[model samples]
Target: MKSAFIILLAALPFAAAAQTTQAELLRRGELTGTRPSARSQARQTAPRPANTASDPVQQHLLQTDVNLAQASADQLPSLYERFIATTRDERRQWTYPQWDAAGQVLARLNQRYEQVRTTLPLEERLRVRSFQGEFHTLRGARQVKDKLD
Candidate 1:
């Protein structure tokens, strides 16, 4: 019975060591913790901004003039479509100078579209063609208004 008591006392330290947490062991530098998983490490690192542009059109539009001018002309139709949609929403609130600027941007975009029409993808070319037809109709209506004014 005295031998059993001595064995139990000797085993107490080992049992207490087993109950110690991984963090505690790591802090004590006695045990190396398992390396973090790739997914877990990524979560711990700096996160990307939620508002950053992800769409190609948004990326192109947000680029500086030099970068935008360097972009593939094949992307013009989509960029123009995005521009038109944005301007259309703000048209009612635009000053004359703002409208003029939009018109100048549209003209430049149209020129770029013409230059790359053949090189553009079939879908983009078709979209531009449709947009051109609608644009002309709108221009004709605007012209009549201008003549009357």
Candidate 2:
């Protein structure tokens, strides 16, 4: 019994860590590409604020960002039809539980934005109109999963 307890305790950290990593990957969509380093993973998983409509770029990006994360998934082709139909105004409704879920999604996308932000050059960044928009669109894909569940 003692040995079993010890084994279970030993396994706890690994289990917790795996769960954390999975959540981070799902939230940030960092697991899609070739394996990323721990350093990059840490950067990509860093927490970010929920969607804020302060900047035009942020506003437009948030408007269109729905479903961006779903694109990287294997089922993307099947999901595209439904994902494209959800509008920004619908998402922005901000009801109780729905707002909570949307907040989580936006936070995840914000982390993804941080990871990719430096990759763009200044000129290209200017053209981006809040590259965060694309990230939001990707994140928006999760909305369908939510609906099905």
Candidate 3:
């Protein structure tokens, strides 16, 4: 009876280890799997972009700027209106960071417009002023939303 009790105690650890799955052992750092391949190691070590431009809002704004730059005077109003509409729609879905990024872009765009205002035709300048006004309005709404949050 004493020998049987000693044997049971000795077998307990083996029983627990046998119940542990291979994945569980790996997760606990008690086992090692195959080494990562060269391709995987290279991917892990690769340098990332300084500005990944991962934000969709920033990407859209860049494309919008390109479109605005190429637009003719006759197309300016329609382009501006489309931009305003898209911005309004996207504003509702934006996170705080996204909204802040948009605000920065709008502010920069307004500044650029102001700097070149004298070079632009009067009609074009007026259109840019309208865009700046819309940007301010959106910014005001964002501020109010931020306060509520």
Order of the predicted models by lDDT, top scorer first: 3, 1, 2
Cα RMSD for candidate 3? Answer: 23.8
Q: CA lDDT, every prediction? A: 0.50, 0.43, 0.52
Q: Using Cα atoms with residue i matched to residue i, what is each candidate's TM-score against the true structure? A: 0.44, 0.28, 0.44
Best by TM-score: 3
lDDT of 2 by residue, 1-149 (tens): 99999967766654443343545654554333234668767764776344343433333424443443322322222222222234344654544465445444445443444445456465544433233343344344444333334
TM value for model 3:
0.44
Better candidate by TM-score, 1 or 2: 1
- lDDT computed for candidate 2: 0.43
In candidate 3, how many Å is residue 6 off? 83
Consecutive 10-residue window with the lowest summed lDDT within model 2: 75-84
Cα RMSD for candidates in order: 30.3, 15.5, 23.8
Q: Report how far off residue 133 is in candidate 1 (Å).
A: 4.3
Top model number, lDDT: 3
Candidate 1 residue-wise lDDT, 43-81, digit = tens: 436552332234343344324232333447656666757
